[model samples]
Target: MVRLTPAQLWRFVKRFEARVLIGLVLATGALWTFLNLAEEMSEGEIDAVDRRLILMLRNPADPSDPIGSRNVEEAVRDITALGGTALVVVITVVSVLAFLFHKKRIHALVMAGAVLAAWASSDLSKMLYGRPRPDLVPHEAYVYSASFPSGHSTMSTAAFLTLAMLVASLEPRRRSKALAYVLAALVVVGVGFSRVYLGVHWPSDVLGGWCLGALWALVGWIVLRALHAPTRGS
Candidate 1:
């Protein structure tokens, strides 16, 4: 290894510290957005607009129907299934087990913990807000829970994004890392949009879920990165 002067080492540490702080900055921004959305929703300031946006995705002639061919609608349902609770849970379990089997116990724990925390937070938010599902249109999917923030959107974004980042960190190539992130993002977007398209959630509900879920994933990723960082004076 090339030994560096103390000054050079200090500069490199400073840069690394700055990069670490970027994660915190992203988490803070997402938190602020979620809080603002929650406040506006609680004040009844955005629901009307949210409903209007959701309605825009429906057939004008028949509000109960989605604006797409039958096959396209089926395709969307399949896409939405990627965010369903059963699938997300299965994915998380597989990932956690993979880590454990590889003797990466810390990674296993972190993965499981982050997904459970996301679920708990989403459930708590739903109970606290007690927001009703949209009544303006017929729901295309079965829903049995309160709908301030779509749980599927929240859970899927949190779990999938966390898993993606964890896997990306294991990849040595930058191209693979970018692809992982891109695919995760697409999944998140598709799930959030599907919630609105299915008419089970208002647009703001999906937006709120996306914000909160992204915040959790960002914070979790930061923690994971810190845990993997080289200890000082090693």
Candidate 2:
């Protein structure tokens, strides 16, 4: 049996890790480009697909009627609340405080900054697009903001995914890291879907939000990793 030297092992590990990071960077870039293209094409117009998808959740006979029963509507509202501004703020604050308590100041700061950036970006996009919320069906949830990009979708994706990345970084086991990412993906998808089901956001709006939010989260993760890297003199 041949034994590999420390230098050889280190080089192999570095190559593997680099490949993973490069993949993430490419995925983020691709999503951002796709979002820009979508915005350019659909800028003052609602696509037929977006209109049909939103309407599918409504009764054909009565456009105002939500497809589900009262219980389902209530359940959807509760799910949507998970991505609401109030809840996202609370979760981000609690996570930051916990990170600070553990003396991980960099992580805490990155998480807070990422979420704030996501919120600001969402607002700016809404202002730039000035797209109105869906009026085809009565909204199942309260909304007062312009709806080009779903704030709930963006904020929830940024917050949950940022937290997931932080947690996954701390896990020494690969399986644990995978689970963290899986849970993050579930939360992001669920929150985005809730917006459409509630009849307050078009499907395209949610897609744009998801793309933006995921890009933000990945950028934050990259920044945090760079910040935490060891100095050469050390």
Candidate 3:
């Protein structure tokens, strides 16, 4: 094994330190966005824009009916289900098992903890915000809680993105990492859009959820990287 000189070792430590700094910046930005949205929502400043955005997806003649065909509406509902509590739980369980199978115990723990924390945080934030569901259009899907930050968007983004990072870590190729993140982004975007399309959540709600969930997932990934640092080389 080639021994790393003092200069090279210093450079390695600095690189990881820079990564940690970037992670902190990203987390701060996400939390700031969520708080700003919550404040605006509480002041009712975002309601008009939320209603207008929701209405854009509905027919002028009928706010109850989404502009898409029945098939598309059904498809949207199915897509939204992927972010529902049941589906998120199932996916998380499977992912944890897969990580364990690969002997990645730390990854599995982080994955489970990050998603559950995001899910709980989403619920708590919803209750704290107590923002009502959009009244601008009829809901195309069932909803049970307050709608400031969409639970589906939050949980799905947390779970799916964390899962993506776990899978990407197993590969040492840039293409694999890019593909994993791309797929997770697609899922997050789709679920967020579906929430708005169904009129169960305001656009701002989805935005807040995405921000919060991404924050938690990024944190988990950063922690994993730090824990695995000893095994890393320049």
Candidate 4:
């Protein structure tokens, strides 16, 4: 019989609990504060920043105008248009299709569940706060939604990040895995920034979206891991 060294045995044992414990502790604490911090200083600061960000994110009326806002507006327009949505939709469809065809029902279920959950959370927050989008800038687009927290930002982050996590787990090589994570991060960040650049979302709205999205994604990951862990062992 082959013998296992103490160090190797210890490493395997440590993997069983250490990472999970650390991830849970940190994620729980951060999400708790993100959800709870309602003190005057924090809320006031968030409000102020949100207002300032809206002002800063607005596009200049003239494309030729010399300003720091030109690039931002272009980026926003490019991303807020159907092109961005198309890209995201394609990615989501592809992922779901792949999972379904491959018979990975669990993956498909989690992806769908996470997206819906994130959107629901975002809509609930909007209704609860009933905050309107900034009116300082001339409305570039037809605006009808409650805009305390950006739903696009939140949902996009949740979906792309979750996809990234799943891809990272499935990929075989370190380089490929890292690339997947980076691309996922870029998608989430790009979507959030696109909302701000469109003048549809206050900076605070995007911030809250990221916080909520990340927290939701983390919770989903934990649940998915728990569900899969036993299957892997079996």
Best by lDDT: 3
Model 4 lDDT at residue 194: 68
lDDT per residue for candidate 4 within 96-117, as digits (tens), equals: 7897887777777777777778
Candidate 1, which segments miss by more than 4 Å at Cα? Answer: 1-16, 229-234
Model 3 agreement with the true structure over 10-122: per-residue lDDT tens digits: 87686567767788788889899999989988998988899899999999998999987999999999999989999999999998898788778998898999998998899
Point out where model 4 deviates above 4 Å. Answer: 1-16, 37-45, 58-74, 81-90, 229-234
Task: Residues 59-116, candidate 1: write the lDDT tens digits.
Answer: 8888998998999899999989988989999999999999888777766776788788
Off by over 4 Å in 2: 1-24, 27-31, 37-46, 229-234
Give TM per candidate. 0.89, 0.84, 0.91, 0.76
Cα lDDT listed for each candidate: 0.84, 0.81, 0.88, 0.66
Ranking by lDDT: 3, 1, 2, 4
User: Top model by TM-score, which number?
Assistant: 3
Clashes of each: 0, 0, 0, 0
Q: Which ten residues in a row have the lowest lDDT in candidate 3?
A: 225-234
lDDT, residue 9, candidate 3: 90
How far off is residue 25 in model 3, in Å? 0.7
Candidate numbers sorted by TM-score from highest down: 3, 1, 2, 4
Clashes of 3: 0
lDDT, residue 210, candidate 2: 83
State the TM-score for model 2.
0.84
Model with the higher lDDT, candidate 3 or 4: 3
